[model samples]
Target: MTGSSHPVIDVRDVSKSVNGPEGRLDILSDVAMQVNGGESFAIVGASGSGKTTLLGLLAGLDTPTRGSIQLDGHALEQLDEEARADLRRRLVGFVFQSFHLLPALTAEQNVMLPLELEGNRAAREKARTALEAVGLGPRRSYYPAQLSGGEQQRVAIARAFVHSPRVLFADEPTGNLDRRTGRHVCDLLFALNRDHGTTLVLVTHDLPLAERCARCVQLQEGRLEPLA
Candidate 1:
């Protein structure tokens, strides 16, 4: 995926704004970026600088108010919600700081959900393999409430990567863990990305985490800069 002719993520003159009680509020003003497949890109910014909003737009979870976003060469703005979801199932994966695993489902079950949705017949086996990759094979039967924070995050990682997405968007992936545990999670994140050749886009405030990426850009005043 290296030396790719086209970027996996291409955002052109994108902007997002929301209606507030005070009237219209502009969150992100015209910003553009290109991220190649298999490359790690970090988005660092101060709180409320719209980093998360931009990530949401790039992932097709939200549409841009102005301009356009191209993910894996498909124009996001042109797709309907169902089409966007279908495209996400086929190409995108997500990791969040909150470790958004279901409270009721077992670890393996959670990991298998995405595959099941896609009608993959070997969902259970693939989920087990994903669990093994994250070193949670023995804990696959445990539910989220029964696991520690780091372990829960590991399960979320397993769930995210189970279907082998071409791109992974992680938002504050290590924000909930202690230093030692955060480092371990970070290592696992990079390992998963490397092994799968998945494009990595991370939004974080941690300098060390930002440094791990091949390219780091800061969002300031609703804009992206190579250096903040």
Candidate 2:
């Protein structure tokens, strides 16, 4: 599905707003974009510029106040919460700055989660394979508290890719690590993406990291503009 004719993500004339004590505050307005299958792009923006909001909507985790979003041929606005969750499980993976691993679960258990949810009988073996791919096989029994920041993030990455999602949304993937460690984690990310042909959508404020992406778009004033 990497180079499929249909776009993996499509946003059209989308807007999102929420009521504030002062008034209605708009997060995004009239934003539209298309992410081609297997393409990698970063949504770069300063704080409060709505990059994460747009990513959330595109990911079907949040909905637009107006307009439409299509994810892998399904209309986001049309799906109910359950359907949206199903779609996400089938086609999407996520990595966050905080490395949202379950504190009690070991690396292998965390990686097996998605497969277990889908009732996969081979979840244990598959999880081991994913951890190996991220060079975490030896740490499969390690708890999050026992691993370094980069290792925890690698576990998160392994969990994300274990399901072989078509699109992977990463928010500040390298924000919490040292420069050298961040570079190594980034290398693993793009390498796995290349291996699996997953379309990568990363959100970050780091200009250098953004420039490393295949393409980047800036989110400004509640709208998107391609970086020149």
Candidate 2 lDDT by residue in tens digits, 143-193: 999999999999999999998899999999999999999999989988877
State in Å the error of residue 152, model 1: 0.5
Off by over 4 Å in 1: 1-5
lDDT of 2: 0.91
Off by over 4 Å in 2: 1-5
lDDT, candidates in the order shown: 0.91, 0.91
lDDT of 2 at 215: 77
TM-score for each of the candidates: 0.97, 0.97
Q: What is the model-wide C-alpha lDDT for candidate 1?
A: 0.91
Pairs that clash in candidate 1: none
